[model samples]
Target chain A: MSETWKAFKPYALITPQTLVFLLFLVFPIVMIGVVSFWEFNGYSMTPAFTLANYQGIFTDVTLKTYLNTFKFLGLVWVATLLIGYPVAYFLAFHVPKLEWQILLFLVCTIPFWTSNIIRMISWVPLLGREGLVNQILMGIGLTQQPLEFLLYSDFAVVLGMVHLYIIFMIAPIFNSLMRIERSLITAAEDLGASGVQIFKEVILPLSAPGIAIGSIFIVTLVMGEFVTVRLMGGGQSASVGKLIQTQIGSLQYPLAAANAIVLLAVTMLIIVSILRVLDIRKEL
Target chain B: MQKRALSFYLLLAFFCLFVLFLYGPMITIFMLSLQGPDGALTFPMRGLSFYWLGQVFQEQRVGNFIEPFVRSLLLGATVMAITITASVLASMGFRQRFKGSTVIFYMTIASLIVPSILVSLGIGVVFQVMGWPTNWFSSGLGAHLTWTLPIAFLIMLGIFNRFDPSYEEAARDLGATDPKTFWEIVLPLIAPSLLGVGLLTFTLSYDEFTRTSLVSGQNNTLPLEIFGMTTNVTSPALYALGTLTTIFSASLILIAYFAYTAVVKRQRGKA
Candidate 1:
């Protein structure tokens, strides 16, 4: 009895967290399923249930909006992977010293500290018509006039998102790459495996879990993307996030909730699909 | 040898360029803050005046930006406190076994993977309904608590998983009460995690744009203010605020690094 009392004492100390989690997190998610059915007007929510919001999203226009948002997100997702892969590869395999790796990694994380909004906005002066790039280009006689197509375009939106999220992609990929046994790479070379073949056959496959983690991180955030698309895409882009925001602004809670629920469904589907494919438990 | 050296040099060059890409826009914003609103990229920049920076401080219109900023900070601080407290307890509780503990643990895991936006929307809708039925409770703290609890649970879970239960057990054996053992032995050991998780929660809370945008009725946080300002193209003063915000944001990352190092070091020593 005393022995069990000893364990019980420690267990009791940690119960508050379990209680709070139940009260806040687990409870609200349960409520979301409930709220999705209820008709929410701005001021007061009606208890009446409807699945019309889900049905509405399947219409051609709304589906097209989702397609466009995914298309953009996918492009940025690929770009972040392509760019971040080399940085992680170099950091893990190429960097000679541990201190340099940490220093370089810290430098990569510095910009992320700034609000993503500021990071997106900062590009305006650099990419704007009379911005630094154009001024420099014109000064060097590379162009006759400021490039009007530079800022507030899909190009800028993709560029800014890639720049902001590439770090998120790199960190996980690096963690996986660092776990690779050094002698294994050397042995591949010793066995007459070419550098490219070793990467293709060994390094790339080994790092898939990290890539999956990073991709999900980027893609899920990208799915609910508002800041980059709004600021850089000039609000002309009606992203799922922006669409939900518009509804919320006017107090269209039911419609907004409906839209948000759709986004949530799509995002959860992607994460589940990725987790299934990666089977990350084995890697961990 | 030359080939090896060349590849090393190439990697260094790429790292330098990559770091530049990460930081270049921020440096540009810093520079632009000092420039006049004539949309000129002139080198002199009207002799580097703080005219726009001053405008952010003294102008009443600046309230639009400052309100959100202050609100974000407040939200961040409050969320930090809640997350640290809750996560630490969860971490401790997590160290023990009970009925449905695995289910509870998996629930925490699920929350971590579930998209923040999804969770935010779900909670935001629920809070609105629950809060609408009440004048005193629903709107303010209730809304924030919904998001804060999930994140704090996840972070505290990660921390507690890494912690050894022996120390706490020993303290309890020596006649410490449950709360006293947590406060004296367990809490001190996990202090760094609390700080790290607290900082991350604060950053996530402060920079939380989408969820706060949905949930905040009349209350504007820093992100919402920036959102509003960006829409109004007339104001270049937002650029100044961006510059200032950039400087302030670095502290979160610094806190994160210190906390991570402390945690990692402790883990290594134990191993």
Candidate 2:
């Protein structure tokens, strides 16, 4: 092959993958950014530039919704981390056999392949007023009335978010844990390191990239989340995503586009901050 | 192994609870779907019957599930083929230091983190501005690609990272051209993982909601239909539908896992 063709081959091979991102991702994002600056006439967007949409991000309701989203994001990130890290530690260090480890990990992740909406809906029967948890409580005479807050409150939103997103946390943390050299742990133990000391000094630091990736996944997903809040919160909550969805539903295109812009900026800000702490790409 | 530690038992118990937490609600949906005609959304299964399951099959108020299922199936298969092919190609290309590689890498990574609603709305608006009508195959297909490609890329990245390039060098030394080397050596080594990722891409597209929500343009995908049912149908029929679809997905994944495991074992044995 000629040197030029050889040099060009990799780019040519990647063109299809590159084109999809340009058309679907970059162009559309630029479109949203442009629309965010345009004026809305109550029905359609006109050509004039305006700051109203950007200004709306600071409005009381908008700010409150963003706060609520951040709350969910924080709760879900911490919950998943608390739950996921131990699970990864167990699978990576505790599991004795490779085959069993793979099997159990698949057991944890298999649900991820199914419909998330169905999984969310599945919670309705388990946590509703007349749901299984309440039934169990009343059946044991623990309550005079079924607890109403189990399904439609912020609790439900956080619970559903945790349930839905724990996988994102577990899979990555497990991946990082598995990649840790086994001999490092042996050496640490041989040097008379206690279990806790070895763990704190060795495993946690090595798994930081997995934890970072997991945190990014949970934070971004929870921040942009609307469906789980809408489903589990039963109109009792407001998220920035829901705000955008509502505005879009009402034909408020420019305002919704503006919300989209602010949301993107906020999401990117969180990710950038995370990247500042640890570069996830380097591990990859 | 050093006699299992006390901490191992504690962690084992915790892992058991974790698995129970993951699957308990799904089991409830599964059991509730088997309830008789008089059964409700919650417990107290009146009797055993397939009444709600049948109801899901012959759709009325919840809209036609079958058509949306077919559309999702088609979209998923299309996405599976394209994502696996594109990601496989790009994964190879990425091995070389091509121009704009960092930009493409970040873009793909951004594709994963960018809000799906934003993607849906952005693509929906782009189609409108371009005066191009969005269909499940056109705009919907593109939107699905945005979701699947990044994931496929990651999986391929994992597979190719552990791949030692000296194997390819040997093939080249044996007078194998680039295509011959890739097809003969690289493809065989990566085939099992590719199969798994392909199936995963198909399933992800099949169940995708947020990205496909605004892009599907009238002909709904199964996820859109199911989400609609969540608002309108409070009956046990919803559980029945969930049970069936979840069962189908579980079977597909379980089968793929075993098949992948078996292939890896056989490949190891041969080597």
Candidate 3:
């Protein structure tokens, strides 16, 4: 082959990916940014640029939606970490056999392969007013009436989000934990480090990357979430995603695009800050 | 070290509860799905039967389940093929030190972290602006690719990282041409990772909803159909559909696991 052909081989090979990425990923985001500045009338969108969409973000509804989204993000993040960390810790430290570790990890991951929507809705039967939990509570005479707030409330929304996203937390944390050399812990103990001391000084710092990655996943997903909040909150709650969806449904494309761009910017900022803290490229 | 610690048992109990928390709702839905035709959505099954599962097929309220199921499968397979091919080629390009490699790599990561709804909306708007009606095979495929290709690229990076260049160099030293060496040596070595990537991309594409929702145009995928039914259809038939899709996904995972293990075992035995 000629020198030019040799040099061009990699670019030629990458053309398909580049084309797909540019057309689908980069171009669409650019389009969103462009469309956000465009004008939208009641019936149709126009090409005129304006800041009206950005101004729309200052409304009480938008403020509440963002606050609600952040609230969900904080709640789900802490819940998933509490649940996920211990599970990942147990698997990484306590599991005596490699096969058993793999088995348990796979068990946790199986549900993740299924539809998240199905999994979210599955909570309806368990948390509904006449559902199993309420039935059991009443059956045990624990309450006079079924808990009305069990379903279609903030609690249910958090529960559903945590259920769907906890595995994302576990997988990354488990990976980071597994990567910690056994000898490091052994050395810590040999140097008279207590269990908690070893964990705090050694294990925790090393797992920071995993926690950061998991947080990125949970935070971004929660920030942009619509379906879970809509379904579990029973339309009682609104999220930025839901707000954008409403705009889109109403054919307010420019306004929705603007909301979406803001959402994207916020999510990206969170992710970038996390990436900065951890520099997870090495871990990846 | 051989003796079990007290903390181990506590952790084990916690792990068991977590597992139950994860699988409990699924099992509940599975049982509810077997409820008799007269039964409602909640527990205490009026009678145990496959009536609702049957209803999933016979009922029109489920919104063309069969066609959408088939469409999702076709789309999954197509996306799987494209993702594998594109990722393999891209990973090859990535192996070399190129001028724009970081740009491409970051773009893939950006594709992943960007919200799916935004991507869907943007693509939908783009299609609308161009007077092109978004369809499953074209625009929907493009949308799915935006998600799957990034994941596929990352998997390929891991695969290629572990790949030894010495083997390819040895093949070239033995007078094999570049294409011939890649086909005979490199391809075989990476076949397992390719299979793994294929499985990953397929499952991701199969269960995909948010990205597909806007670009899917008139036709619904299985998840989209189920999402629609959640609003109107309040019955065990919904659970039946969930049970069925879970079964499909579980079986795919099982088959892939077994195939992967068999290949590993055979390779180990030969070595």
Candidate 4:
């Protein structure tokens, strides 16, 4: 091959992938950004640029929606970490056999492939007024009446989000934990390090990349979440994603696009900060 | 030293509970799916029968489930093929240090983290502006590709990192043409990763809901159909659909696992 052809060969090979990426990914994002500044009439959106959509988002309702989303994000993050860290640690460190470790790891991942909507709705029978939990509580004389607050509340929303996303935390943390060299821990032990000291000094720092990656997944998913909030919170809560969806439903494309752009910006900021803290590129 | 520590036991207990937490709802839904004709959506089963499973086929309450199920299957297969082909070519290009590669790589990653709803809205609006109707094979396939291709690219990056280039060079030196070398030597060696990618992209496309919601147009995919049913359909039949979809996905995972193990064993034997 000639030098020019050789130089062009790589570009030629990458053309199809690049085309798809540009047309679908980059173009849509650009479109959303452009649409965000346009004017929205009651019926249709016009091409005139305006800041009204952005101004509209600076309201008490939008503020409450954001506050509610952040509240859920904090709760879900802590819950998934508490549950995911121990499980990942156990699998990586305590499991004695390789086959058993793989088996259990696969078991944890199987639920991830199923439908998220189905899994979210499955909580209804367990947490509803006439559900199993209420029945068990009443049967055990734990309460005088069924707990109406068990389902269709903030508690239910957090439970659903944590359940759905805990595996995302476990997978990354377990991967990073497994990558840690056994010799490091052995060296710490030989130097008279206690269990807590070894974990705090050696294990925690090594797992920072995994935790950061997992936090990115959980936080972004919770921030842009609509279905879970609507289904579990039963319209009692509003999220930025839910607000955007409502705008889209009403054909208020400019406002929806503006809300979406803001959500994307906030999500990207959180992810970029996490990336800055730890270079996940090396881990990947 | 061989004796287990107290912390090990506590951690083991925690592991088991986490497993239960992950699988408990699924198992409960599967059991509820097996309820008899008189059974409600929740517990206290009337009796065990496959009546609800039968109801899923006959009932039109949740829209036409069969049509959407078929559409999802076809779309998944198409997305899987495109992802594998595009990712392989892209990974090969990545082997050479070229200008603009870093920009493309970051773009793929950006596609991965962008909210699915935003993509759907943007695509829907674009199609409307262009006077083109969104359809499953066109708009829906594009939406699914935006989600699946990024993941496929990441997996391909890992696959190519471990792949040696000397094998292909040897084939070329033996008088094999470029196409012939790629087809005979490069492909067979990387077949295992391709299969794994195929299975992953297929499952992702099949179970994709949020991205396909607005852009899927009038034709509903399985996930879309199931989402529609969640609000109104209150019977064991809904559980039956869940159980069925879970079974389909689990079977795909098992097949992929066996194929992967077999490939590894054969490679080890040759080595």
The candidate that achieves the highest DockQ relative to the unseen native structure: 2
Model 4 lDDT per residue over B121-226, tens place: 8888788667799998998999999999989988888888999899988998898987898999989998987887899789989999888888888888999889
DockQ per candidate: 0.47, 0.79, 0.79, 0.73
Fraction of native Cα contacts kept in each candidate? 0.53, 0.79, 0.74, 0.63
Tens digit of per-residue lDDT, candidate 3, span B1-271: 4234778888999999999999999999999899887888898888989888888887475465999899999999999999999989999888888888888888888788787888888998888778898899989999999989998898788889888899998998899987898899989888876787788788889998878877898888888888998999877888999999988887887777777778878877997
Give the chain A TM-score for each candidate. 0.90, 0.97, 0.97, 0.96
lDDT of 2 by residue, B145-190 (tens): 9999999998887788889999999999999999999999999989
* TM-score to true structure, per model: 0.87, 0.95, 0.97, 0.97
Q: Using DockQ, rank the candidates from best to worst.
A: 2, 3, 4, 1
Candidate 2 vs candidate 4: which has greater lDDT? 2
Candidate with the larger DockQ of 1 and 4: 4
- What candidate 3 gets wrong by more than 4 Å, as runs, is B1-4
Model 2 accuracy (lDDT, Cα):
0.88
Model 4 spans > 4 angstroms off: B1-4
CAPRI category for model 1: acceptable
Give per-residue CA lDDT, model 2, range A127-205, as digits (tens). Answer: 8889889999999999989999999889999998899889999988999999999999999989998878888999888
Report the C-alpha displacement of residue B63, candidate 1, in angstroms.
Answer: 2.6
Off by over 4 Å in 1: A1-32, A38-45, B1-4, B36-44, B62-69, B131-166, B169-173, B233-236, B255-271
> How much lDDT does each candidate structure score?
0.72, 0.88, 0.88, 0.87
Mind giving the per-residue lDDT tens digits that candidate 1 earns over B96-191?
676566776676655555555555555566666776532112333444555566667765666667777788779878989877886798777777
* Candidate 3 local Cα displacement, residue A34, angstroms: 0.7
